[model samples]
Target: MRIYLYILAGLSSALIGWNIGQFFLTDIGLFKEFPEVTLFPCIAISLACGMVMNEIFISNPTRPKLSWRIAKTPLLIAVGLGTLAGLISGGISQILFLPQIRFPTPIVRIIGWLLIGASVGLAEGLTWRWHSMEAGDPKRFWQRFKVSVLGASTASLFAAAIFELIRTTLGAMPAEFKGVEDPLGFSILGLLLGLTFSITNSPSYLGALRAGTGFEYTGENYEDIDPNLQPVNKSSPCIDKSILKFVNNGDAYEIEEGLSIQLPGTGTVRIGSAVKKANIYIPGLPLHVADLELKNRDAILKPNRVAFNCIEVNGERLTSGDDIRRLKHNYVLTFYSEKKDGIKEPKIYRFVYYNRFLDPQA
Candidate 1:
């Protein structure tokens, strides 16, 4: 469902942008004075494409709703990069297709559209954050750049080639719809660029975290169920049985159910009670209970000082000072909290980790 929304957003934004550009170029007489004036429409299309792509990237179900204030910085960066790309590609295309240059008309159109698609892809790639990379990871930028640019460009080239074939083989349309080709072509390019990027960046499921037998209540007894937690198969076999719930207690939101968090193949994810800070937020736990690091398909659980005496993995208490334990399939992490009566209850919350990639059942 979400993927379909993304594709729709991409296609619509591109079509609208292209129409806006066309209006300015033909209707407003901007292109009649100078051929180089085509850059304006390119800029419009690129800016719209950039904004939509960035919005899709930053969206998260567990996070707060996005507002203009929260999304401005990244959106601005995307716009700037996208505009620059548009300028370079548009300028180059114009120069290459000049009458004096004698370039083949079909070849020129194909190259121009390909460049436009690549520029949008490049901007999106540059703004993307690689979740698997930690600070100072040297390969991060290069990896993102390579994947985004190549994927987008290839998709765009394919779209342009198809559009060219349709235009040449089908001949011109009716006089009333004579100028519809550019907008239609741009829309196709946008759809393909977005589709290719999303397919390439789809998450590879390492496994999931399920509520263990010892797990307690997820929310207050009187609280209504969260709509986002509605039981539905997310299509991933590992997380088919898992459900997520968000509990708001005025100050912050908490994860009531053991949600399946995508553990990056490499990098550390903090597990704690801090809203918006912890990768996996468990209510009533310390702000920083532990760090779960993935290395070579192994999950390393390191308990922090505040949670040393409270955390137990597979029924063994975690001690203070850098004690790290490896997690296995069906291993339960039990968290304890003292009740108002001063009794320390065991198994306040239990998270069972399962790695389907290596499991025989998978």
Candidate 2:
């Protein structure tokens, strides 16, 4: 299952990278003469990045010789993965898009595939390994994912802005399009587009940012989120392997920092800590309890409207009608009570989880 997920992620990343590359290439006029080279690299990079995304984000011990061997395996696999992704993406683009778009010949296509895979592998591997996404909790999975995407997309947008600026200086970009080609304009536009791709694809660049920087998104869709908002760190869902076994609470309940929860007809819950957040996840629910309420200090709890849908952190709330604003490293959560008929006192349950750095780094 894990291996398959990695492959799927790699394929999607390749497609997104190719599409983003094509968008830029078209603006730069590379679409006309060297269309082949323009997109191949993007596909290759995305796949390569995807191939190693798991190792990149999850905690693992560093052994030089072992690391080398693992690294080699992904690189070797990337060749094939890149080729497959490129061909599929290119074919889909040609079939569905404008007639003016050109598809590389069979031989050229294969060569392009190889190059793209190699380049994407190198770029993604280096970046993801160096900077990985951290998963504070399941509630934070998507939030961190978006943050990672934003980081990579920001990088991509910056690159495009620089390119446009250079072109303007060289008078390569026409004066008529000058307004359209303004660095700020290009950057804004590229940022939106890159964000769209990142969200849809969940590439390692975005994932890496989430892990390394502790960034995340609380918004529904990344493109709709404010650029001025603070950046989110991409987080991985999997706990570090070395620590995973020890921290095993047998899946009772879990929560992380900077999260808030609201329970229907009850109250609110918020949880966060100083220095670092806790890793929170819930296993089985007690049979007696029907639902629960979680809210922050200031939130007004409504009745029968909100059901405990697990956990919420910072600005990302889980249940419907739950609202989140900003993500803070520090947070608090209040778990509400559900009582049955004839029961006077609300039955409370205990939540268990692992705290900061219980196990040594792998």
Candidate 3:
């Protein structure tokens, strides 16, 4: 697909250049006497077409590698359709309203037709601006509309200038258009065009400026959003693997700083810690409940001062009854609930840490 577009883009450009430079700039009758002189222009036009197509056609073609490939089907289509449309428009204007539409040189008139056509075609799709036009508010829509125009104009300027530059380098450009023949002018124009393309395509610099917040990929349609208003880091939605398993329910919920979950049973089995309230507090649960909190990548289990003597880990009773302790992986925690039938067999829970560094199935 790209190769086909490249060929078409190159051919359209070459036709526009050949007509303007060879037929209009020099005598057609002297071609046999001066074939050598015109050969350079022919080569220049070919090179120009190739260069333009390579720059505009391929996906990510702007990289420094020599681009025999490109993605500029739109440009080629535009030049062809735009030229034909312009020719028709010009013919109609000449016949009905404007007598001044005629040019002395037929080749010159044809070249004009192609150039105008190319501009129209290029302008139509080159700038993604429908969203800007459909923007809900008038002020913002106008802003985007202006940006669209600027972007299209910038691309067209580069295309027209580069096309002429290639022709001039081949010594095929006519004297009338030689005023823009300066290398410095071409260089500046190229730099500006490159800058515009880069600025528009890049998501960080301009996206940050436009969004005015931490970057987020908030939408699905790229065309609906301005190119300059998206994040460089496109994020995808996924489940957080860092989680704490609920032993009683078999539910795995994500673990984060200040996280808390309640395990429901005879009493609330609170998971996670707090200073004022237990994460799992049931006033009537006969067992003294402590909060199990995951913080700083560590699980903290602490008992209230009044329930200090009630906590036990891995079948060993906790000696430091009032202090917080780390809940290690695979360790068993037992809680004894005081009841009318006296202290019964304690309910048991095991601690398991879901390691994020481990691979899948680890």
Candidate 4:
């Protein structure tokens, strides 16, 4: 049953994590008599139990080799990322945390980094990747990061709770002290490091969907699969989505002030240079946008420095405004304060009723 596979995955990850951590803990002399305790034997038994559970209830009859390879990528990525972080953190410790205390030399620091990275890669990666594969596409970098945060937080809380329970049961919790190592206390240092990993280097929800839909990595980036799911472009507002609606019989049209002006309710704005040399200005509108249709369908705002004699609605000028009441229909704006010619060119400014903040479903 899939439930058994899930159980086996969790138990295997946790036991393996604990076992690998035990060797490091023992090395640091934190648990001096760890060998004498039944913990090692208990761990071995748990591993056996997981293996049997998988073999009996969750064995795959088809494409075992391919499945194994697919599963291995997460493990590899985890190791690579973990090792990188440990070294960086250890090196920074010398500069940041070590000045307050005596510290290790360069070679010793390198060794420490390797140990930390390896432990974290093995422990956190196994658990998170195995359990969270359903949440999104592993290739979706942001989705991965979000799921990683959730998974790491869960694991940390579980590990910390278990550690605290043991401490309470044995009455061996370390006393509060300044800069003193408690020989008997145990900390899931990997969990702390994993939190950072999840935040910085995770995949996305689409990754889970990709994995679910039988998507293969093929040695390519995960995002390569979903061309339709690409993130919205952020560099220019021109590519940004616009909201324009037709109001009654009115239409959208463009004005010739180096900006595209849509007719009231008319969706099309005439894209061209203004006929008059006079500049145009709109006031009292926040987040104002002066959309200009450049050649080749590119829409943009007017250059502010070239049209500097204007105030903003809400930090930005109104190329679009929420209240269509006064702005709706067709209104002409007159430019040029200097009265040279008796004839004045009117720039048409049309307002369309659009809720820029409207919910799509609503």
Candidate 5:
């Protein structure tokens, strides 16, 4: 359902863009004097399509405040790529339509539109790869490259075929509707391009965090949320392993710092205070506070050394060396400072996990 929304967003934006381009190019005679200026409309249409699709792809519900700002970079990248594609295709189309060239009109139009679709897909794939790199998963570079190439090729072929079919079908309409065929065909072309990109880039999992204090903290009280934190609503290429460190700031417990790292497919994730060794490091915890093993979406936590006294799962304190807890969706893991008394309350950090695939509302 969420996936469908992305496709719809892309389609609607592109359709509107194409119509606006048509109005300027045909109705207003914006480029009548200079035939070379016609490419402006192509660039405009691609910009609208690419920006809208990229924005939707990067938007996340959890960090609503930062969505637009965060999307700016990726959106620009996609738009630039799309615009380049538009120029290339539009140029070729113009050359093909010259009186000297005797190419079939339909074939020329198909080739132009197909390049637009393929460029958008390629942009999306490259943006996804950029995201993976930022998330510290450079190993998946080849995988992403393959997916992008395949997606772009498929989009190009499908766009060429579909655009021609729509135009042909619409051409068969009554004489009065003849003028409307181009606009209608453009709308469907936009829709197909968007659908192709969205389907190819959907993610496998979505992840988010919830505050365990039962109250939302705002106004600079909590530590700045990690910029790399996965958006709760957006599709995630891979699961994230995060470590959040907190401190009692006298008034209330507040986050001090946080890190979101890519989770390994098979291995023990060591959690401790040693920045040099632990995958997740909490300031005051023992050098080896715990070892977390992920199995089939479940997190199995095993306390190490003196960690039995410092860790709590779902509010129950760890009591013995043999005790191991399995956590799934909505589970809470709390770490407490061993100190008894001080100017501030004992430091408490809460980590909440939500699986968006199982609970989309989260």
Candidate 6:
């Protein structure tokens, strides 16, 4: 399912990119005027698709959302550099085909515009997708450069078709810039852009597990179930069954991140900063919830095998989205209810791992 989603995302990005490029050229009066293809409509559709895909694939629930304020500088630098490279590449191709002769009325202009579109597409790929980073090998700087170069080359190959289709000529000598776009000039473009993207978005590249789960609250109150009034029933059946099972089995569980649905609840199940597989959810907790796969020897599950890690305590993040995090052995997760909204913290629910699989009350 993960692989399929990634594949779907890749195809979606490509389709979005292709349309964005076509619209860019179309806006400035290129692309042989195909009927029913207006620049504005294409731009709108392409932008919409790009945004949808971006949210689906690039947006991380655990991490703070990247605002336009944060992204603006990166976007500006990327677009500017991309446009410049496109122009340079276009000029080179023109020199090769139109060597010693000048074109009439902006055939060069057409190529320049088309290259800018190609450049933008490459920037999108480099900025968001490149993540493989090996630390401290002849140092981090050179390693990052290598990875960016590889990723950029791959991205540019896919993006080159955008420039190739522009169909420009000088005095009827067809510009054979197709060869130059993919393997050579675009590689250089990718190299530069990749370096820029890596340096600018370094936070994402480090790829460490985020610490401190987000917490929040609800306006509604369940007074009879008041955590302050009543003691937390650790053995409550409503406590997330799937997650508690890990604790029961005596395996260490780390909440690497992301899940929803507090499963099998008669009233409300308190799942603190953990995602449960419940068919129903009545939110009033102060913790982020998520279901995810975390592999580590420190965990109690079959060393390195996928296992469930849910905490049955109510929690809600005040900022960002839900974010459940790494766990410690025999720890109590405290969170607040809707009634406790004004209070900064939630009630506590503790889990004790019983080696049911290993012992029978000896």
Candidate with best lDDT: 1
Model 1 ranges with Cα > 4 A deviation: 33-58, 61-67, 130-141, 172-177, 204-349, 352-362
TM-score for candidate 6, please give it: 0.31
Give each model's whole-structure lDDT: 0.58, 0.37, 0.37, 0.32, 0.56, 0.34
Per-residue lDDT over 30-135 for candidate 1, one digit per residue giving the tens place of the 0 to 100 score: 7654443465335435544543444444344334343343445546666665666566666766776778998787776676666666666666655444222210
lDDT of 5 by residue, 1-362 (tens): 65566557665666666666666677888765443236434543463445344534444556555555545656776767766777778778788888798999878877776676666656665655333322223434456546655665565567567667766776777778677665566656656655655665555343333444412333442224654443343111112134322111212223223322333444577766565577655555566778877654556788985677888888898898678986666777777755745536656766675432222211
lDDT of 3 by residue, 132-241 (tens): 11133244345544553465355545655565556557566567666544333323333333344333322111100011111133446333465334323323111112
TM-scores, all models, native as reference: 0.56, 0.29, 0.26, 0.28, 0.60, 0.31
Q: In candidate 6, where is summed lDDT lowest over 10 consecutive residues?
A: 353-362
lDDT of 4 at 67: 42
Q: Which prediction has more favorable lDDT, 1 or 2?
A: 1
- For model 3, give the 10-residue run with minimal summed lDDT: 204-213
RMSD of 4: 18.5
* Shift of residue 284 alpha carbon in model 2, Å: 30
Sorted by lDDT (best first), the order is 1, 5, 3, 2, 6, 4
Q: How does candidate 4 fare on TM-score? A: 0.28
Candidate 5 whole-model C-alpha lDDT, 0 to 1: 0.56
Task: List clashing residue pairs in candidate 3.
Answer: 57-70, 57-71, 57-72, 58-70, 58-71, 82-117, 83-117, 270-280, 272-292, 272-293
**Of 3 and 6, the candidate ranking higher by TM-score:** 6
Q: What is the lDDT of residue 159 in candidate 3?
A: 53
Q: Return whichever of 2 and 4 wins on lDDT.
A: 2
Considering every candidate listed, which one attains the maximal TM-score?
5
For all the candidates, what are their Cα RMSDs to the real structure?
Answer: 13.6, 17.6, 18.6, 18.5, 9.7, 17.0
- Better model by lDDT: candidate 3 vs candidate 4: 3
